[model samples]
Target: MQAKEIREVSCVGAGVIGYSWALYFAMKDLSVTVYDINEESLQLAKKRIHESLETLIKNNVLTKEKSEELEKSIIYTLSMEEAVRNAQLIVESGPENYDIKRQMVEEMEKYTSIETIIVSSTSGLLITEICKNAKHPERFIGAHPYNPPHLIPLVEITKGDKTSEVVVEVAKEFYTLIGKEPIVLKKEALGFICNRIQMALYREVCDLVTRGVCTIEDADKAVTYGPGLRWGIMGPSLVFQLGGGQYGIAGALKHMGPSANMWLADMADFKKIPDEFAMIAQEGVNEELKNRSAEIGNDNASLAEYRDKMLIELLKLHHKL
Candidate 1:
């Protein structure tokens, strides 16, 4: 069945990611049943959803009345059977452990219809490994959303070895219909796309600070005030294409390839965070947020609000909203 025909979606696990998925589906006018074993977590999920909906309304993404209506569309339940009974799509955001995910998939298979499309919100785990014990692995896929899934537009839809092309397409269409920018991966790889690129940049950032080349604050400013500004407008590849002048990417590479190769060779190759660097990183982040936390109260929440607000405006400018 086509994604547009799917009216009910079940979100397993009421953690932040699952709750955000529930909220997004509800906001798009789909019936969402969120299942979690913990009542307290469910309550917290409800609270966050309410708070995020208010933020969305404030940002003009939704009317107050519409937000209220959407809030009602989400149903919280502790029973997995009840959650998946009528669901056409199941989004599982349980623990990231392979064994836990494997067990969850196996249990969910017992409750869901054979046609139900199951997807995981795993960051780095392979979908094939997660669905190894599934009765029907072809119905399973990976639908990794960035943190705050409701706000982030990108959802990476990846396939397992046994995941059918039709299921992948349907998953992509489903996410797209719910107002996400869904990119399908040809094959499963660790960290998918964004996270891999994100970690690569993070590694270099840590390397710079660890080497005393610059403070964390300076590194942040360098990105935010420099390439980051253009990055928000276009990806690095396209930016380089523009840098190529009339010759585009090829010309830009020809001019800068030697210097780029030299820098690449000198990049850090550490697989884990060094102990000394970890201390420096922690201290730097704390120092950066100290004043901002005092001013805004609840540093994380305030920063998230600020992020969502800016994202709404940026998405609007990009015609993504």
Candidate 2:
């Protein structure tokens, strides 16, 4: 199906990701139906949907009136049939477990046509495995959105072994139409794109803290005040192109490679997280939180508010909000 033909969206599993997807689709003026297992879950999803839009409203991304109007576009349901009835796009934000996801598609296929595009919100599970038993695997693909989908623009799209190229293109176009930045993987990779890069950096942070090279607070400050700042505006390669001055990325690499290679050689190489660092990182974050002002948030809820506010301002600069 064409992107323009995807006028109705079905969000299965009404957790944070699912509801946020519903909110974004609805905000873009698409009709969205959210399905969950029970009233309590759907109710929680509704509350979260409201609160997320309120964040957008507070950041001037949406007026209160407009947000209310957008809320009208979303409907919550417990019935799977009701959810997928008229949906051209089914965004399954269920569990990350392969078996559960596999089962979800089995039930979903009973209700949806082969023409309906099914996109799993699995973080790292291969879509090929997830859809192997499906009646219509060709329409299935993986679309992983960064947290708080209404605010974040990154959605990594991965194709299943049998997934149609047309399905991939239609999904990409639909996400772009709703103002999301979608990247498609040519070949399946563990953790997709952003997660690998994020985890790689995080591994170094953990390594530095464990080795007593720096405190968690200092590492965070370094990133927030350093490359993270430039990265928000432009990607690292583009930033390095400017950093190279008279030269480009190739020049920057030439001048910076020796020391970078040294640092890389010394960086973390472990596959799993170091066990002791969990408490170490938490303690450091708690200590870091103590230093923050109330206006910038000293706790989880307030910090989220602070993050969404800043994110909206940044989105505005990019002409996205």
Candidate 3:
């Protein structure tokens, strides 16, 4: 079915991610059914969903009345059959284990029609293996969202070998319909796209700290005040294109390539992170938080609130909310 034809969607598993997806779908004016096994989880989802709507309201994402109206639009269910029977698309955000995911897929297949498109929210698992035993494998796809999918706009769509091209397109368009930025993966990747880029940069930070080049807090400051600001507006390549002046990116690379290569040579190459780094990183984060002002948040709870508020403002600048 076409993207526009998708009116009813099911979110299988009412954990944080699943409930967030349900909230997003409802906000987009789609009929959403959230399914889970336990009643407590569903109740918790209801509470979180209400709080999330409040966050959106505070961010000016919607008016209070509109939030209330759509808040009641979501239908929560315990039976998988009741959830998927009428859904044109299903987003399974079940446990990230092979056994758990495979079991969910088998159960979802039983209730969902063969023509219904089902997508996994698996971050690192290969879509090929996840749907390998599916009765309707062609209809399965991977649509990994950034954390708190309702707030974040990016969704990475990947297709398994058995997935249909049409399914991929529909998934992309469906995410677009909900005001999200959706990117299709040309080939399967372990960390997909953003995660790999994030980890690569993070690895360099770890290396710099371990070598005494900079402290963890200083590294955070560098990213926050430097390239991170620009990255929010434009990608790195485009920023470099500007840095190249009239010469463009080619010239920038040509001039910087030698130094970049030397740095890359000195960068961390270990497949596994140094185990001692975790404790050190935690200590660094504690110090960093302690150094911050009350306005910016000096603790975890307040810091998260600051982050959400800041993210809303950024998303506003980009016209996402």
Could you tell me which residue pairs clash in candidate 1? none
Candidate 3 whole-model C-alpha lDDT, 0 to 1: 0.92
Counting only residues 3 or more apart in sequence or on different chains, how many pairs clash (N, Cα, C under 3 Å) in candidate 2?
0
lDDT of 3 by residue, 289-321 (tens): 989997787898788778888888999999888
Name the better of 1 and 2 by lDDT: 2
TM-scores vs. true structure, each candidate: 0.95, 0.98, 0.98
Candidates in order: C-alpha RMSD to true structure: 1.8, 1.0, 1.0
Q: Candidate 2 regions off by >4 Å?
A: none
Question: What's the residue-level lDDT of 54 in candidate 1?
Answer: 87
lDDT of each: 0.89, 0.91, 0.92
Model 2 lDDT tens row, 268-320:
99998989889999999999999999789899988977888888899999988
The 10-residue segment with the lowest total lDDT in model 1 = 290-299
- lDDT of candidate 1 over 48-124, digit per residue (tens): 89988889889999999988888887889989899998999999999999999998998799899999999999998
Error of 2 at 214 (Å): 0.8
